[model samples]
Structure formats: C-alpha cells, structure tokens
Target: MTLDEDDRQRRLPAGRKAQLAAYVAETGQVTVSALAERFGVSIDTIRRDLDQLSADGVLVRTYGGAVSQSTLSRVDRAVDVRLKMEEREKEKIAVLAASLVEDGSIVMINGGTTTLAVARNLRNHRDLTVVTNSLLVPPALSPSAVRDVYVFGGAVRTLTLATIGPVSFRASGGSELDISCDLALIGVGAVSTAAGYTTSNLAEAAMMREMISRAARVAILADSSKFGRRLFAQVSELGGADYLVTDSTPPPDLLEALAENEVELITPDTREGAPEADQDPQ
Candidate 1:
C-alpha cells in the first residue's frame, strides 16, 4: 500500500463491521481493494468483513467484494407466483400509475400483474379507449366505463396469459390506421441502471417497445424488488420512459440514473412536488 494510505488507516475509527455494511449499502457494490483503501485496512480484513456480512444477510457477497442486498440482481418468476408476491406494493404502484391517465384518454397497457392492477385501478375512469395484448386486462376493465377495449390479436403465451406477435392489425378489406395513445403503462420483468428495462421473453420486450412508441407518455410500473435486476431481453434504454412508479425509493445509484434519464420517480413517500397528474394528465 502507499505510505499515505498506511498513515490514514492508522487514524481510522473502529467498529469496522457495521461501517463496512453501511458502506456497501451506500455504494451499491464495492470491490475488495477499493474498500480496503477507503477504510484504510488490508484486503484480507475487508474479505472477512464481507463474508460475515453475507452470512448475516446484510449484503450479497460477490467475486471481488460485495453488492448491497437491496440492489442485487434477480430474475423473473412464474406468472401466478408473481401475482402473489408484493401484492400491496404492486397495488400502490398501480394506483400511482393510474393517476397518469386522463378520463377520456386512450391508454395502452403492457402485460404484467402490476399492470393488471393498474387496469383495475382505472375502473372509475370514463370514456377511456384501451389497447392491450393482455388477455386478462380486457376482463379487468370490462365492467368499467371504458368506451372501447381493443385486444391485439397475436400468438397467446400461456405462461404470461398475454399475446406475443405483430404490433399491427389487419382487416380483410382495409389497411390499419396509425395507432396512438396518450399513456402507456408497462410492467417489466427486471430493471437496472446498467441494463435499463427488460423482460424474460423477447417477444414481450418487443411488444412493450412498440406500445411505448405509440404513446405520448410512458410510465413504468414496478415494485422496488424489480430494481437492479436485468433480464434476457431489453425493452428500452434508461430515460426511455416519462415516469417510474414504485412502492419505495430506489437505491442511490439507480435513483440518480432514473433522474438522468428524465424519468420521474413516484412512490407514496415521493409525491410531494409531482404534478397532480389526475388533474392535468395531458
């Protein structure tokens, strides 16, 4: 180590284990050498601390050092299983997402449990034009005051109970008109600052992108667990959407990334300065 670093280490405070955990949480992921130098300690000491933190479920151990448990990457689950997980958080996100839709606006919804809840939350909206590929979504809004519900015709994927195919429709005697919507609410499989938005299925990702293309405003509905996770197919890059609706604030790095993308983050605790979307959802 450098002589200055050695001197600095000697002056650092004790109670390193707790400090180490907090450090990991703040930075998201850290490497052994970097942490050691930052804390003015040996690499071996940092490794030991990381191991103990991993065992305690305080952090997730990685190849070089450790990643914060809160931002550790994850994967998609079965549709039914996903429906049961994070029910309340999803509902809150759904409610917030629904706030982005105006009463008479045409809105496009991508398929997912959270997006399904978003559809249900729109029950009070009237004269709404809805377009979607989700088989389940149409039924959710059937009893609502929605004026027209257009289900995209495509190959049905039983796993997600959604359709996957072309984004356009064909009529025997005529070509289709250009489609547009005011808002597009999408639920993704995984979301990370590095990978942006993604889903496990390629076709699903493509459909989501197409839906976003046809909308004037885009809101991504995801619970906090979806943060920092990446999947096989990318849907859009960071800043690709207008807003991110979640149950809680994202990690610092992710929060900054979303801000950089101009993606307004909306959570129960973060609605302070946000537009009263329901009042002027233009």
Candidate 2:
C-alpha cells in the first residue's frame, strides 16, 4: 500500500468500513477489486466487509461484489441478460400468443423481454395496431408490418429500456382511444397464488394495473421460471389476469387458484416437436 493510504487506514479503521457501505449505497453496485483499490485495502478485507454487510441485509453479494439490499429485493436484472435466458421457450410462447390475436386487432404490450419477443412476432401482421411503453418495441415494428404503432411517452428506465413515471400514465389515462386496447400482453418478474403477480419496478406495476383496467382482456406472458416466485411490487391479484400463457404447467396449488379465478391456462403443444414414438433409428 502507499504510505498515505496506510496512514489513512491506520487512522480510521472503523470509518473505512462505514465509508465502504456508503460507497456501495451511492453506486448501487461495486466490484471487490474496485473497492480494494479505492480503500487501499487487501481484497480479502473487502470481501469480509461485503460478507458482513450482506449478513446484516445492508447489501446483497454478487459473484464479484455487492449491491444495495433493496436492489436485490426488487428482482431487477438487465434486459440484455434476461433476453438471453429461456430463449426457445419465449419464442414458442410468443408465436402461440401472436396466433391468438386477429389481424385487425388493437393490442397493448407492457415492457419486458418476453413481451418484446411478442412484439417482434407481431411484425408479420399487416392490419394490427401495436401500442406499447417499451422503448425497444417501436424500432422492432416497421410501418408496413403494422398499420399503426403507439408508444407511451415518459421517463425511460435505463436497465429495462421501458418508459415509466407519471407522464406515461397520463398518456394512457382515461377510457379513451389511447387506452382502448382490445388485449394486453404483459410480462412479470414473478407470480404466486399468494402474491398474485409482481414485477421489479413500482412505476411499471402502476402502469400495468392501468393497462389491465383499460383492456378488454389481459393475458400474462410468463415462463415456467417465473412461477412460484414473488418480487417486491404487486401489479395485480390472481383474478386480474384473464389468460396465462406459459411453456409448462405451474405448481398444482397455483394452478388450482388460477382456475378458481377463471384464468385460462395455455401451454405449448408437446406434439409439435416430439418425434414419433414408433420411429426407427437411422
């Protein structure tokens, strides 16, 4: 260590850990090596600090370092990272979902990687109007593919690339043409019978609730991984959704609750890709 750094560490041992926690709070996330370099401490000491902070629920540890506990509780992940996961399942779900809408329908899609996949699948429909809050969706829908595309304007969430805040809500407010959607295709971070449906952002949840209220029918597009998990923000109850489209069946209890709520469950048809049972080996 530099002589200046060593002297500073010696003078403020307790203060250093406090400052480390403060740094993590300010930056949202940090790496062990970066923390070590900043504090002029050994990497092992930084690791110990992170561990203690995590144990106290002050922060949550990642593979390299730590992030604020609140960030972890929200279950937020970057859109790029999420897009790469459950690729095949999302594609199949999107295709099946696209089939449900008529050519001339007006559809609303909420912001999520899976819903973005759904937006992409609708490109072939020439007579549809696609309304969305996702910044990523507009570029994906060419004018020739859909007759009209409407996007809600608001503050953009950098991580998810979706528009949120009060402005977006106002744009879609009231029972008017803006919010008069035939169907809504929504995606969520987690779902449970007890917690209902939840996403990572509160603003997004608020927008989703309004979208659900305005739409004639609401369909939740979720992968099997989202089932049984509950995140920080509740978007709606089990009864809010009219349909659930997924790759596989959820837990029996949740399924029972969904059925009781009259939510239609749609799963991929297994026969589409299965080889014939009696097929001979080459």
Candidate 3:
C-alpha cells in the first residue's frame, strides 16, 4: 500500500504548480481572471494560489491580486505595509494628482506612499521636471522615456525614506522653479479642519509648509485615514490647499469643512478628464 516517489510527486497539484510558475514569471502580481483563464481553472483556484503564495512570503495579497515580495521590498514595510493596505484608494488619488500635471511643467512632490503613486502614473508624461525629497520617487520615474528628476538633498529620514531638515527646506526655497511649479502634490500624516495638514516631526512639517507656500497650486493627496486625525506639527491651515484629491467619498464633517474652506474636492473617476480650474487670481 506504500506510494512510490512518482506517486508522491503526482500528489502535488497541477494548479499549485502553475500558479507558482506564473507568479515567478510575473513577479507575483496577476489578475485572478487572467490566472484562471491561463490555467483553465476556476477563480477560486487562483485565489488559493494567492493564499499559498502569501503564506510562503513569496508575495503580498492585494485587493484584486498579489504583488511580488521584491516590489514590496523596495520600501521599508513599516511604511509600505500601511500604504499597501489601501492600494486602490491611493492609486485613485494618484490618478487625480497626475492629471494636475501638465507636460513640460515643473513640479514639487512630497514624500509619502500616495505621492509614490503619483510618480508611478507620471511615467508616460514628457519633458516634466520633478523636484522631490522622497528617495522612492526617482526610481519610479527612472524608466520613463521622458522625465527630468531632481532629488533634494538633506538629512534622510529613515522611517519614510524622505530627506528632511534645514538643508532640504533651503534647497527647495532657493530654487526659482518655472511658475514655482504648476502644482505641489503633498501627502500628510494627518488632516483636520482646525489643524490643516500636520506631520509627526516638526522639521518635516516646516519643509512641507515651505513647499506649499512656494507652489502655485497646492493639492493635497490624502485618503480617508488622514481625515480628522491630528499630528504633532501643523503644515498650514486647510485654507492653504487649492484642491484636495481623495478617493470616492470622504466623511461628511470633513467634506463640510473642505467646502467651507473653498477647497476643490477631486476624485479619480469623476475628475480624471476634468480640466484644472483657474487658480486664485491673487
């Protein structure tokens, strides 16, 4: 009644084997329908593949699919884990932020997971100059056919992999950017009607505030989690932002506050094709 070696090997499921191979080829992220169609299996079978891969630490299970361990490894997981937790929502905000950028325009981007999404979506754009303090941004735009990137110099903050401190702020302040940027896409640790955008570190908050001051259009890219939360230092009052790009819907109170501040609220699907509104004619 003993099973032979070949019999034992045969017990290993074909579906699992195919999923592993697909994951290896695609570097772990694949749509469930694509995997199912590729293997002529059910959607449930692909889901099982994703579960096993996640258990093995070979990939991270995302909302619709799985992303490779290597892709997740690029950023420190402490930050990335929190980011990946809301992939679709962030990307939605990113898409809206990207639309704000014009070709051949100069822009300053802040450091955060949501800002990283904006960098990714900007790949197809051309002749754009980007000034950023985030270490993660340059690599995102590096493979693009067009794009000029400048990474601001300063003391590196390990937690977020962003450059902070006086040097970074000074460099940003000294630059005579064209139009001082068409927009500055920023990410905040927290946002409240009373406190505006805030961050945990005082120095970092100062740098962000300086960037906001210098930009022509100030767009804050925040998700629902940022709303209503307060942090250590204030970047600016909500009045500073010209627009706030977020996911589909935000909390009612926060929405009311944003409207009161006269901040333009943008969502990905609704605003993707919309033109940039006229900036305050101050």
* Pairs of colliding residues, candidate 1: none
- Listed in order, each prediction's TM-score against the native is 0.69, 0.67, 0.66
Q: Which pairs of residues have clashing backbones in candidate 3?
A: none
Maximum-TM-score candidate: 1
Write the candidate numbers in order of decreasing lDDT.
Answer: 1, 2, 3
Query: Residue-wise lDDT of candidate 1 within 133-184, one digit each (tens)?
Result: 9998988884566999988888998878899986777677678767889999
**lDDT value for candidate 3?**
0.74
Higher lDDT: candidate 1 or 3?
A: 1
In model 3, state the lDDT of residue 66.
Answer: 64
Report the number of backbone clashes for model 2.
0
How many pairs in model 1 have backbone atoms within 3 A of each other, for residues 3 or more apart or on separate chains, i.e. clashes? 0
Strongest candidate by lDDT: 1
**Residue 26's C-alpha lDDT in candidate 1?**
92
The residue ranges of model 1 lying beyond 4 angstroms of the native Cα positions read: 1-76, 272-282
Candidate 3 positional error at 8, Å: 22
